[model samples]
Target: MHKEGDEIHIDEQEASGGSKEGVVRWVLAGGLILAVLLMSIVWIIPAMTQGDIEEEATVSGEISSMEGGDSTDSIVGIDGEPGDGGEVTQEDGIEVIEN
Candidate 1:
């Protein structure tokens, strides 16, 4: 009869130890989930939702000089009023086109 009581007490102790380990496992899992959520909000989400860079040129009446480049330097210019005979000249690192 005494041995039966001892066995019951041992089983209870083992059950409580298992419960503590289960609680620790849950706490670690929750911490990892929270860290990932914060990282997404502070870094990943903003990086994914950023706007792309765009360049546009629009000419209405007359344009003096317009410059744009992606991997090289390029310039477009019209040096006088419309219908005025314009001279196109080439300079170092500049390109000119006559229309």
Candidate 2:
């Protein structure tokens, strides 16, 4: 009867010990997830935002002029006359049509 009591006491101790380790593991996992989220917001989000701005700047720079020369005069529309719908005309020796 004493041996049976001792075994039950040991089992109770083991159960408590296992529960403590489980709680510690859960806390550590929660802490790691929090750290990752914080790092992403602080570092990754800003970098992504900055990347979009940089891409826009690059696109604007590319559109400023074509490869060989200044292309401002070579381009038309918006600055030129608004076209009559579906009308064909000749301008700058190029056929202009609005469809």
Write candidate 2's Cα lDDT for 60-95 as tens digits. Answer: 645643464745655445334556235557899988
Instruction: Give the TM-scores of the predictions, in the order they appear.
Output: 0.34, 0.34
**What C-alpha lDDT do the candidate models reach, one value each?**
0.55, 0.63
| Per-residue lDDT over 6-46 for candidate 1, one digit per residue giving the tens place of the 0 to 100 score | 47335665656655447888999999999999987898666
Measured by lDDT, the strongest candidate is 2
**Poorest 10 consecutive residues by lDDT, candidate 1:** 53-62
The residue pairs in collision within model 1 are: none
The pairs that clash in candidate 2 are none
User: Global CA lDDT of candidate 2, please?
Assistant: 0.63
TM-score, predicted candidate 1 vs. hidden true structure: 0.34
